[model samples]
Target: MNRWFMTLLASLGLLLIVSGCSTKKDEAPKDPKAAAYDFSNEKSFVVYGEGIAPVHTVSPAQAIVLAKRAAITDGYRQLGEKLYGVKINSSETVKDAMIRDSRITAQVNALIKDAAITDATFKDGLYSIRMEITMSARRWHELFSY
Candidate 1:
């Protein structure tokens, strides 16, 4: 009887230790490549854009595809806004002008011939995209010279 009781106690202790040392399943996995890029340099610019597609008559795969396409287009628009700059009439605040009359905002006419897509992600039914734009000295001179 004494030996049986000792064995039971040892088994309980072992179970306790094993359960306590287990890692949490709910913890988010870390991405090693997320921090690989440095955007502090003034020579380069980074922009992010996101798009959400409503679940309508389309299947899940189709929805995701549409969302990704929208995200890429939105990213390009954001990059164009950053590069060409948005013009608003002085008579009204930019926000008000945008809300009341979108025509007040100058359209981007300059061509963004090249843009690098840094990252693309989909989570919680929304698609997000990141873009990086680098302007060389010659490109800047060409843009201004025209």
Candidate 2:
């Protein structure tokens, strides 16, 4: 009986080890929205006719704040549903939040392909990002109205 029990315990341990080793790695998703922007022209340059204004630069602190705020504004109101009315769990790391936020932005960009949301740039502190999007008035109306 003692030998049988030892054999059973060893088999269970081996099974658990094998099962754990078979766990798959988490894959980073390829964004379909990004696929739309892929092209052969890699060294593209913007030509200014001395008419366009320069772009603005946002600081890191401002970027983080903007990112958090934009996450809420862009239909992700789940963060605010906790008892505190706006509870971003203190235990959650900023890196984890940023990764999730980036994924959300990618998915949203995919759905709004007509808008041609080509790219996004984030400053360090801002929760919001500056997005480059192109779309006709008709397309915009159709998207939001639907």
Computed on alpha carbons, the lDDT of every model, listed in order, comes to 0.73, 0.40
Candidate 1 accuracy as TM-score: 0.55
lDDT of 2 by residue, 55-120 (tens): 343764554555545543442222112111332322333574473332122112223222122234
Cα lDDT of model 1 by residue, 1-146, tens digit = 99999999999999999998896865644664432232333356688878897779368888888888888888887777877877655444357446543334456644676678889999998999888878665556457544
Top candidate, metric lDDT:
1
Clashing pairs in 1: none
Q: Which 10 consecutive positions of candidate 2 have the poorest summed lDDT?
A: 44-53
Compared with the true structure, the alpha-carbon lDDT of candidate 1 equals 0.73
| Model 2, runs deviating above 4 Å | 27-146
Name the TM-score of candidate 2: 0.22
